[model samples]
Target: MTRASRFRSLALAAVCLVLFSVLGYAVTGDRAPLDSFDVEGRNLEDWADDSRAFIDVLRVVEHLFATVGMTVLTVVLVLGLLLRRQRWAALLALVVMVATSLSTSALKVWLGRDRPEWQGTDFSPLSSYSFPSGHASSTAAYACLLVTLLVLFVRRASLRRLGIVLVVAWWLLVCLDRVLLGRHYPTDVIAGSLLGIGIFALGLALVDPRPRSTAAHAEPLPEVYASERRVAVILNPIKVEDVGQFRSVVSAMARESGWSEPTWQYTTVEDPGTGMAEKAAVSGADLVIVCGGDGTVREVCAELAGTGIPVGIIPAGTGNLLARNLDVPLYLRSAIDVALNGQDRAIDLVRVGGDGIEDTHFMVMAGMGFDAAIMEGVNEDIKKKIGWVAYVVSGLRSLMFPAIKVEIQVDDGEPTTHRARTVVVGNVGFLQAGMPLLPDATLDDGILDVVIIHPRQFLSWITVAMRVLRKSPIVDETLDRRTGSRVRIKASTDTPRQLDGDSVGEGRELWMECIHGRLLVRVPR
Candidate 1:
């Protein structure tokens, strides 16, 4: 952690400590000034008792955030972190919560504060001390941990803001529930919240939860050449939350991997990646790292196809299809490490051309009809806020898109006519969440896999989904599969089209040919 962040955390912990001490002293002494706050809390409880329904809701909230409930939530969160390979973060969460809860129990016993006279009898009788509310402290600690994780991991500003808002709302609801249900005084919750937050801040000051730098443990590989290795970065500026931080990370990792300082190129609105890639190649970069969506990756790969310069991909898009297929890590630092040190593999690229669009290449998939419509119909604003979930919303709306007649010709075979809702041609098999839409597809294979879906009724989609998920070999009119090196799809009318999850406008025809081992890309060894 940086010095400034450490100092800020120390300052916050100190402030919370001072406030908590003062409140504890005032509450334990005779006729203390803070006692009036508890009196006001009792008055609020009297008003709340008038509404049986509201009290009933608070009772449910109380049970949900009680000791047993919070323990379950904490265990789930820590296990999830461990499953995601966040060892340091999981350790930090476990340590901070356990330490805070134990400290709170000890303090309550030491203070020996009694429950309020107005404590409700509608629920179980209180045998525990009430000066420091356990519900308030546990919720505060969990909230702090969640906010820290969001800051460290979540990249999208809108999504981070939403997560923080929800966390804060949850904490506030727990605090309010304790006071309104006559379980604890307002001052008791205040002290409990401070105790929890203070311990968390102190813990953060001592522990950095980010994964350790790979350079610390990585072994040197045999030198490929005796000359200085040159690296170049082609970045899509808007794809990252902070450009400077991304640059710093890439530069640091490259240096550790024995590469010279990298030359940088930023993608522009007019030219997403083609021009930048050409510049990197002309400058004689040994390895060019491209950080953007699949479209940018496609452009760079196409430009550097036969030049023998391997491309490294740092996927920063909603659907990182190529990275997923290549088994590249999605965690930013892990992806960077793989880019700098992993082996290079030659992969096939699909050349595509259709009416109303220029000739182009796709490294992942191309689609026509309902799937394309979902991509086109996505709300840009909502997408900015929630990432890929916006696609789910759009997909639901376009699930019943009317089927259209299309002609499919694979390789030199005779054209076959069929009615379909969507036709997807994939250079790689899986979609997001490991959905095996094209189970037979392989990246280096000189063939394209096609799937034709014609779910006539709404319920038929369920069957199609089950078959896709199971990778069932059975093919029928509902879901037919095809494969060829060269495929031509001609729609009866103009239909929506997308390339690698990007909408490429409406067209009546899409022609694609798979080129064998056309490009070299970095992949895990």
Candidate 2:
């Protein structure tokens, strides 16, 4: 943590402590000043007691955030963190929650305040002290912890805002439930919230939950060269939130991995990555890290093909098909670690050409008709705001795209004619979320897998989706699959086309040939 951050955390904790101390002092002893406020706060409970329905709802809310409920939530949160390999975050969450709960119990016992006589008889009476509300404290701590994690791990600003809003709303409901159900006084909830917030702030100051630098845990690799290894990074500046911070992180990781300082190059509107990648290779870089979407990855990979320099991919795109297919981690730091320390695997690249577009290469898949229409119709502004959700919006709008007649020829076979809503040729089997659109496709198999979908009606798309998801081998007019080292698709008329999720305008034909073991990339060891 920076000095400013540490100072801010300490200041917040100190403020909470002072407020809690004053509140505690005022609420204790007979004839306390807060007694009147606490008594008046029961008016909400009096109103709630008139309606059994409202009382019952509050009771459910009470039980949902009670000690047992909170325990289950905490355990799930910690386990999820551990499963994601965020061990430090998991430990921090466990320690802060346990410590907060135990501290609340101790403070409640010390204060020894009695529950209000106005407490509802509809539910079992609490035998515990009432000065510090357990529900308020636990919920506060959970909300704080979750917000911290969201800020640390979630890259989308809109998503982080939504998560924070939901967490805050939940916390408010719990606090309101405490008062409405006559479980604790307003002052009691306030003190509990302050205590929880204070403890969490203290924990934040003491434990940085981010994963340690890759250098801290990785074993040194065997010396394979006598000279210092050179590394380079080609970044699309718009993809990351802070370019300077990203540069710092990559530079630090490169240093710790024993590589020389990376030669940095940012992609431009004129040249997304090809020029930068060629420059990096010409500079004698041993490793080149590319951080961008599938289109950018494709450009860099095409340039670096057969160069013997391993490419590290950091997936920072709406559709990171290449990285996902390669089993690369989406988490930025983890992807960096894999890039610095993982093994290299040779993968296939597809060379594609069409009528209206220049001959280019794609690392993942190429599509025509409906799929390309979806890509072409996507609203760039909306995509920038919500990431991949824009694709869903576009897909829904283009679901009933008219089918087009096409001829497909695999290898040296005679051309076969069919009507297809979409024709997709994949270098990798799965699309996003592991959807097996082409189940038999393998990255380095020296062949391309093709899927032709001709859902006649709007409802027929369901069957198409089911068949793809189930990896069904039954191929007919509704859905068909073919494979060959060289595949050519020719539409009867002009149709939309896409390469690696990028719209490449309307074209009547696309010819693709897979180059086996064409490029080297880093993957988890």
Candidate 3:
């Protein structure tokens, strides 16, 4: 995470804790507002305290899931991570668990407030400080950790959402149990939840630092290697820490392969890489190596499309969709090796125009509606912190984004209108999450694959998610699909749009056509 963003989250956490502390002081002084609410809540509970059955049930839930149950769940989660060979993740969980427990205890001791002495039938005897309910704090803490872990570790959308729902429900039930059992006031539970959240935000920075580690696989091999001689590399300086080191690596590899010292071009925020790529092709470069994210790669690929010069990719982005589809290694060393020694393969590129985007190209997919909303709404700070987990967070937030009515027309076919949450056009099947969004789509297929999702309800998304996960052949009205070389879509309104995860301004119409085997890219042997 960036220092400024980290500071903002930390400041928010600190503000919450300070607000809770002030409330604790005011409650001790029997001040207005908080004290008034607490006393009123106590009186209401006393007036409504008739059923021992519900209280007994709540007590049972508290006893089963509080201290011991929480500890057991933590152990099991950590053990599961360890079994999965995620030692870093397991260690992180352990640290956060211990930190949360100790911090909660310390806060409780510091506050040193007594439990409610109301006229209600209290199910359990509590002889400890109650300014912050330990049960509520611990439960919330567990929920935060487990959800974050799920967002980070779980790849399947269905399983991740299910796990999050179950975890959150378990904790919410625990909070209700504490409040209903008359062990804590509403203020105490609220404070506890805030404290848990604060600790979680803090732990994200302290326990596990930013820029988390990614697995490094062995260097990959390339197919037939032939160099007509000259090479040029378009580099994105912001994407790498030490640009000199990357350049040195490329130079050493290129020299080993009997190629001349490469012509280096740096991409700027204003001009990503297109102009440089064109210049390289015009200067008779046999190969153009792009060492940057998808945006840079897209620009270079689009610029050199029909020049017969192969483009080598060195992926440095979070969602390197094109590289992933091309079976290119992600590691810098391996990707450089492939760029220097790999064979060229012809692949299809989808050209998308209109809808505020003029004559742009997407080697992966073009999406509108819900998918575009996700790309447009993803939090920049969170994305820097947790990588793809940021997408999950954005996606969850955008699930309720209104659907759009779109008329899709394939080549020489009649237009069909549907209320769709998203309409995606793809040249490749697998998504960045490895979900086969268009199972039958292939880069060299010489056609475009389309999928339209129209979930009847929010829960119906599970059915769509399952279908994608299983690569089901079930194509019905809600999950309709079509394919053609040319596709024209007109939305009912000017909707958000994206070409390979990059947002194109809102537009009502999108015209796209596929160019088969139009570009050459390097891939693993």
Compare the candidates by TM-score and give the number of the best one.
1
* Winner of 2 and 3 under TM-score: 2
Residue lDDT tens for model 2, 141-174? 9999999998987787887898899999999999
Error of 3 at 312 (Å): 0.6
The predicted structure with the larger TM-score, 1 or 2, is 1
TM-score for each model:
0.91, 0.87, 0.60
Candidate 2 vs candidate 3, lDDT winner: 2
Which lDDT tens digits does candidate 3 get at residues 88-109? 6677677767777788788788
Better candidate number, 1 or 3, judged by lDDT:
1
- List residue ranges in candidate 2 displaced over 4 A: 1-31, 46-83, 94-114, 119-131, 198-208, 212-216, 466-477
lDDT of 3: 0.80
Worst ten-residue run, lDDT, model 1?
212-221
C-alpha RMSD by candidate, in order: 2.6, 3.4, 11.1
Error of 2 at 190 (Å): 2.2
lDDT of 3 at 483: 93
Query: Candidate 3 regions off by >4 Å?
Result: 1-228
The true-versus-predicted C-alpha distance at residue 337 of model 1, in Å, is 3.1
TM-score, structure 3 vs. true? 0.60
